[model samples]
Target: MSTIADVARLASVAKATASRALSGKGYVSEETRERVVSAARTIGYVVSPNAASLVTGRTKSVGVIIPYISRWFFAEVLESIEQALLEQGYDMTLYNLPSASPERDRVFEYFLARKRFDGVISVGVELSDDEVDHLHRLRRPLVGIGGAIRGVHTIAIDDVATARLATEHLLSLGHRDILHIGGNQDEQMDFAVHSKRLSGFLAAMHAADLPTNDAFYACELTVPGGYEMGRSVLGDPRRRPTAIFAASDEIAIGLIVAARELGILVPSELSVIGIDGHPYAEMFRLTTLEQHPRRQGRLAVMSLLANLDIPTPEDASESTVLATNLVMRSSTSAPRAPLHHA
Candidate 1:
């Protein structure tokens, strides 16, 4: 490997002059700088990134802590953020924090302490007050996605409003007895997302004076999870709700599947609405609210990068809820005249 000494000898300049020219920190004449650069290129010389970071105090990398990777929305967001970082010549180091546990402490006390990252972006997993303070002490910028932090820059859709919108869509179709197949909020140990979504469903039900009780079945936030819950809920056709609101598109797809198996045709006998424009939504011909998770990811990165240079705003620790659209599909329809009973 060619060294700085070799470049200096080839450029006919002292090592200190070559260092000044290459580092770009101190002044070097234009002609001298050009010669040093040319000599570097000729010798196929490359500066040590670690050494550069030591001098410049920048790692040019961002650390990301995400909760889940198997989910469609989160995975899409991760991919978008990765691409955006790559485009900007920044590296991303991912830390998968599946459900809050002692492992998260290791990430905070050990991994993040390395100071290898210029900033941090959290996806879906909300950080605790202590965690935020710890990062603040380290002077590392932090951005969040999925929901707002009390004092952190974040990007996400209003879960409450989005859920209410889904419910209202069914109500617009004249669905009175609506069931919400939602996540098991009680089991949500890491984040408050499930409760927020459930609250939105209840808020809409209260606004319309509808039954949002146990008929509001709890389901896993996946297609298979939704299918299992849907089968049991829809089995008793005599008690099944006229319409269903799934917390996510995955659940909605599962509900639709269960409806098919039970000989209950969608829209004709039962209507279903879901959040997220999951890829399968198109294949299953389901109605959904298209919340661009990838766009949110990119936006979070932008916000985080901005904070790396300037101190984040007082409201920077807050959240910016992105907008969504009601992407109407054939999955929703008016309740049957006689109310089809299995």
Candidate 2:
């Protein structure tokens, strides 16, 4: 097999310099690093992970914990993280912690305890104090995405603010009878995101002095979930809301589909808005506050890498709040002249 010594000889650099360049550890001049890499590529000199870990005390792999892999947001985030890890010459180990599963506990108590990774990126998975302590004991760099975890580096959009922005948009269009289709607060998996979003919706309504009783509908954060609830909620012409603020673009799309099935004209009869810049949002022309999950994922990986390089326990954990923007589309508009009653 082509060895580091052969690469070093070919690059005309010392073996130690070649090791530093290929391992991405100790600093080497950029020009020298490029030459070493080029020489290594030419010789097909691959660094054995086992040897690298023994020398640097780093596995060069990152652990990623997520709630649901099938969900659109989670999937997008996972893809981004994977791409970033690959670019950084790190492997990724994924742990899917489904709700109410014993496997979830095992992941924290056993799988992560194995010390297989140099760092961890948690997506939409809130770590308990004990779990955090356990990871700290492992001394692995940790970063979170989707919500804040005390003493852990985190990247998240302000869920409440995003939802409030979506709600305020409808309210600005003179929509007094606004209904919110959001995730079930009691059943949420991470950081009470559902509750935070619901709070934002309520805060907006309270600011406008609008009645909020019976204004919220809790459902799954998916298209099918929204479609099922939308059909039932939007079915009643007399009691239907004038505008609907969906917590996610997927839900908004489903609600729109439901409205069409019931022959309800959008914007003119019912306005709709949502969060998340889902791929289908543009196709559906959904008015929404766009929070990029994929970007958030990439940011989390980058943050974790930074933390890994500076392993200082005394350093205060960072909470990065990403920005979101309102994407105006055809789904939302001013309520029609008499506001269709029944």
Candidate 3:
């Protein structure tokens, strides 16, 4: 096995220069790099990873920490991140953090301490001060998606604003008796996205002087969650909110199903709106606020590459905020007078 030392001796270059030249990771003069490459090729020198890490201090891998992989948005984000990382010639190691505090702590204390990746992308995993500091002290660059970090790069839609937009759109169509089918109030995800979205709903309702309190129905962020909640909330014809602003398209789809099963009609009887451009959203013809999680994942990778290209400053972090727009569809309209108060 030809070692770097053998390449250095054959090329008559210093070991350090030979390492840099062979790896193409750091700065090396063109002539020197070519000579080193030639010598490496001649000797069939394959750089040892352990040996290379001892010199360049990089694992050439990325750590992606996420909360929910089974959910639509999270899955889409992961796929986009995977594709982007592959194109950049990098490897991604995923860390699926279960919603448990002790397990979450173990990820930071034990798993992160292993130091296998060059950097990290916390996909919807909010980092605590200690966790952030631990990674920072490890000299790892981090970028957060789906939430905001106190002192690191982040990219996400304004969850509150987007929710408000959805609500107001329903209100604009004169649907005042609106319900919000959303995530649990005890969501342990990094960003309190569920809470933020609910906030938007409340803010919009308050702004329009519409009824909002107790109108919120909490559920997990899944079709089943929505379906279960819809059955409970919409089961009673006397008290169902005329329109609903579901947290995600999955929830909206479930709402539609629940409504139909209960012999209630859509648009003519109840209006529905949701966030996330879920694939089933189109199939269900749901009106939604289209924030593409997959595209957001791609953009997050782009941002990471951008920061990786330049020299990352120790004390400074680069942040980028993406944009979201409302996508109107046939899921919503003014409630009929029978379902609305005049």
Candidate 4:
């Protein structure tokens, strides 16, 4: 029920002075600011975010656009972003953009146009030039995670190189009959992550002079997707690969589960390696390349905040690539014997 006017009266200051003191905008003497804040606390007065935004040209809120919420990577990234924003005294509004939905257009053309957020962090959602231009026209600071968009600030790991390293790990362990269980290239979202990862696998195989025929299998980028593909591929001992380089940790976990159900011993009969250091990776004892999505998410927020502070069009758009580390575990080992093919 208390208002800024009441607080101003209680503090014996003009409403404008009270506004300046509370918002930390314009010039207000430190003594006067303390008095105004004391009065506001006494009266339980709260500044209207809308009014403050009008005065400071900032909502103190951010919009996060993401493709999948249920997946491990996206969920971890989102949790990190939310925690970082909260610590920075900001709010997050999430927009889940499912594939093949008109909601993406509505979010860009309507919701974002409302100026409810001061900035945006897009996770794995590629933007068209027009979309990027629209956000730029509104002067909303934008940061992308997972892939690059032309003319947009981005934070991502080297997808191709990471994949190459994962494959190379398997190769170094003397894995000749290797298979890649990765995302479906044709069904990939805007970023073409599936294609990039597959390219990395192929690049490593070619570099090592390994066989490439029938080496790639397309699946959803989830545990269940990997489980299904693993069942089909690892069912027959004669056709089983010596090792599998899964595109993600979730997929690798799924394959491990499937292999267990099929009575196939891992590392002894088949080896598995994956990307991401998912929480369950250690339990599964899966060797992996850890990209640390949570850290990437937090860094994305930091990048957006930095850009907001010094928003020069030229300086705001920079691409940052993070690194990945190889984690050794029980799931990967050299084949027991040379694989023979008829």
Q: Sort by lDDT, best first: what order? A: 4, 2, 1, 3
Task: Please give the RMSD to the true structure for each candidate, in Å.
Answer: 3.3, 2.8, 4.2, 2.9
lDDT of 4 by residue, 1-342 (tens): 999999999999999999999999999999999999999999899999889889988889999999889888899999999999999989999999865568778888899988578899999898888788888887788999988887778988898999999999999999889999998887876688889899999999999998899999998888999999999999988889989999999999999999999999998989999999999999999999999999999999998999888775733457889999999999999888856899
Q: How many backbone clashes does every candidate have?
A: 3, 0, 1, 0
In order, candidate lDDTs are 0.86, 0.90, 0.83, 0.91
Better of 2 and 3 by TM-score: 2
TM-scores of the candidates are: 0.88, 0.91, 0.83, 0.91
TM-score between model 2 and native: 0.91
lDDT of 3 at 43: 79
lDDT of 3 at 234: 93
Clashes of 2: 0
Error of 3 at 136 (Å): 1.0
Model 1 alpha-carbon miss at residue 197, Å: 1.5
Global lDDT for candidate 3?
0.83
Q: Arrange candidates, best TM-score first.
A: 4, 2, 1, 3
> Which digits, one per residue and each the tens of the lDDT, describe model 2 over residues 36-142?
99999998889999989988888889999988898898999999999999998899999987664677778888999875799999999888777788888888789
Per-residue lDDT tens digits for candidate 3, residues 214-308, read: 88888877788888888999999789888999998888988999998998888879899999888888888899988878878888777766766
- Report the error of model 3 at residue 72, Å: 1.8
